[model samples]
Target: MKTLIVIPTYNEGSTIERVLNTTLEAIEGDILVVDDNSSDATKELVRNFFDTGRVFMLERPSKLGLGTAYIYGFRWGLSRGYDLFFEMDADNSHNPAALPWFLKELRGGYDVVVGSRYLHHTISVVGWDFKRLLLSKFGNWYAATLLGLKQFTDLTSGYRCYTSKALKAIGLEKIKSNGYAFQIEMVYRSHRKGLKVAEMPIIFYERGGGGSKMSRKIVREAMALPFKLRLEAIRHIFKDNI
Candidate 1:
C-alpha cells in the first residue's frame, strides 16, 4: 500500500523535529505535516525535511482544531490516491518506533489499527502521574461504555492507522468532534460502519516539550460527544426502519 502519515501540529517546535526524524527512519511511508498556522517554528522545522522528497506540508490559515487538521490531510491523501493513512501527534509521546507495527496490522487486513496505551488490561503509559493516569482510564471507560465500544481498550488513543477503505467508509465530512472526542468518534463510526478495528499495545510517553493542549473546553466536548454520536446512530436507525 502507498502509505501517508499525517501528523497534526500546532506549537510543537521543540519536539516536532525529533518526531519527524524518527518517523522518517521508522517507516517507508511519506509524511504530510498538517500545521494549523503554528505561531512558533513548527512549520519551519517540518519544512526543513522537504528536500527529502517524502515530506510534505499543508498550512492552514489559523489555529484550527485537531480534527480539521486531520480531515484536511485525509482529503489530500485521498485525492492523490494514497492507500493507507496515519494519525500521529507532533509530541514525542506517540513513539515513531511503533509505526511499523501499525503498518503491519493494517497490511494484515485490519481496517483500523489503534495504538493503545491500555490494551488487554495492561497500562503501558509512562511519565503520567497517578491523577492523570486515573483520568485517562476513567475517560476511556466512560467513552467506551456510553458509545457501546467497550471492546476497544483505548477509545481516545490518538496514535492509529487507517486503511483508505476504512477512511472512505466512515464519511469523514460528517465527523464533527474537534478534540480528543475525534478519536472516539472515528472508532465509533468505524464500528457502526462495520469496519474491522484492531488494537495494538504501545507505550505512550508524556510529551518531552511544549505545553499540554488539554483544556476544560476540550474535556467538556469529549464528555458530550459520545452521547451525541449515540443519538445520531439512533436517529439513523429510526430513519432506516421508517
Candidate 2:
C-alpha cells in the first residue's frame, strides 16, 4: 500500500531534523511536511529533504490552524493516490518506529488506528506532569461519555493512521474544527458513521525543545463541546436520527 506521513510544523527547528530523519527511518512510507511558513529555518531544512523524493513540503501562506494543515496534507495525499495516511507530530513526542503496528492493524481491516498510551503498561509515557496527565485522561473520559464513543482511549493524540477509504468516507469538506478539537471531531464523526476504529499503545513524550502552544483559550473552546454537541444532538433528535 502507498502510505504518506503528513507532519505539520511551525517553528519546530530544534527537533524537526531529528524527528524527520528518525521518522523516515522508522516508517517505510513517503513523507510530507506541511509547514506553516515558520519564521525559523524549518522550511529550508525540509526543502533539502523534498529534493530527494522521499520527502515533500507545502508552504502555506501563513500560520493557519492545525486542522487546516492536516486538511491540506490529506488532500495532497489523496490527490497522489496514497492508500494510507498518518497524522504525526513534528516534534519527537510520537514514536515513528511504532507506526508499523498501526499499519498492521489497518491492513488487517481496521479503518482508523490510534496509538493509545494507556492501552498497556509496556508503553507508558516517559515524562509527564501529574496535571497534564489528569487533563488528558479527563478529556478522553469526558469525550467518550459525552459522544457515546467506545474502545479508543486517546482522543487528542495526533499519532494516528487513516486508511484512504476511511479518509474518503470522512470527507475533508465536511470537517469543521480548526484546532485541537479537530482530532476529537474527526473520531466522533467516524464513530457516528459506523467506521471501525482501533487503538494501539505507544509512548508519547512531552516536548522538550519548543514551548507548548496550549493556552486558556484552547481549554475554553474545548470545554464548549458539551453545549455544542448537545445542540447538534437536538437537531438529530428532531430529525429522528442519532
Candidate 3:
C-alpha cells in the first residue's frame, strides 16, 4: 500500500530542504508539507526543489496553528488515494530512516503504529532538560489516565502511522485542540473507535536546527488537558441524551 507523510511546517527555512531531502531519499512514498505560510522562504524552497511529483507543498495564508495544518493535510492526503497516512516532526528529531518500521508494522494488521520514546526500556529523547521531561511525563500520564487509553506511551508523540481505516475512524471533524493536546485527543478518540494500535520504540532526538514551537501558552493548555479530556469524553458518551 502507498503512504503519504504529512509534515506541518512554520518558519522552517533553515531546515526544511534538508528534512525534505532526508525523507524523500529514505522513504518510498509521497511527502506532503503543509506549510503554515512561514514568513521565511519555506514554501519557495520546496517548490524549487522539485519541478514535478512526489514532494509537494500546500501554502496557507499565515500561521494557522498545527492542528489545522495537519487536518488540512490529512484531507488532502485522503483525496490522493494514499492508503496509509503519517504525521512526523520536521526538524530532524524524527528519523526518516525509521519510517519503514511503521509501514511494516501497519502491514502486519495494525490500524495505527506510534513511534514511542517511553516504551521497551528506551529513553531515546536526546538533549532535553529534566524539567521539560517532567512536564511531558506528567502531562502524558494524566492524559492517558483520564482518557483510559492504554496503547499510547507518549500521548503527545507526533511520530505516527495510520492506515486509511484508522484515519477515517478519527473523522477529523471530531478532533479539537491546536497543538500538543491535539495528539493526545486523537489517541483517545481512536481508542474509543476500537482501532488497533501498536508502538515502536524510537529515539526522539531534540531538534538541532531551530527554536522549539512550544511556548508558555501551549504548556498551559497541556496542563489543563486531563480535566478537559475527561469532560469531553463524558459529553461524547452522553451526546445522544442531550
- Scored by TM-score, the top model is 1
For model 1, the superposed segments whose C-alpha errors exceed 4 Å read none
Where's the lowest-lDDT run of ten residues in candidate 2? Answer: 117-126
Among these predictions, the greatest lDDT belongs to 1
Predicted candidate 3 versus true structure: per-residue lDDT over 68-92, tens digit per residue:
8888988998888889888997888
Q: Give candidate 3 regions above 4 Å deviation.
A: none
lDDT (Cα, 0-100) at 204 in candidate 3? 89
lDDT of 2 by residue, 199-221 (tens): 88888999848767677766666
- Model 2 Cα displacement at 65 (Å)? 1.1
Task: Rank candidates, TM-score, best first.
Answer: 1, 3, 2
Residue pairs with clashing backbones, model 2: none
Better of 1 and 3 by lDDT: 1
Error of 2 at 172 (Å): 1.8
Task: Enumerate residue pairs that collide in model 3.
Answer: none
Which whole-number lDDT from 0 to 100 does residue 206 have in model 1?
89
Steric clash count of candidate 1:
0
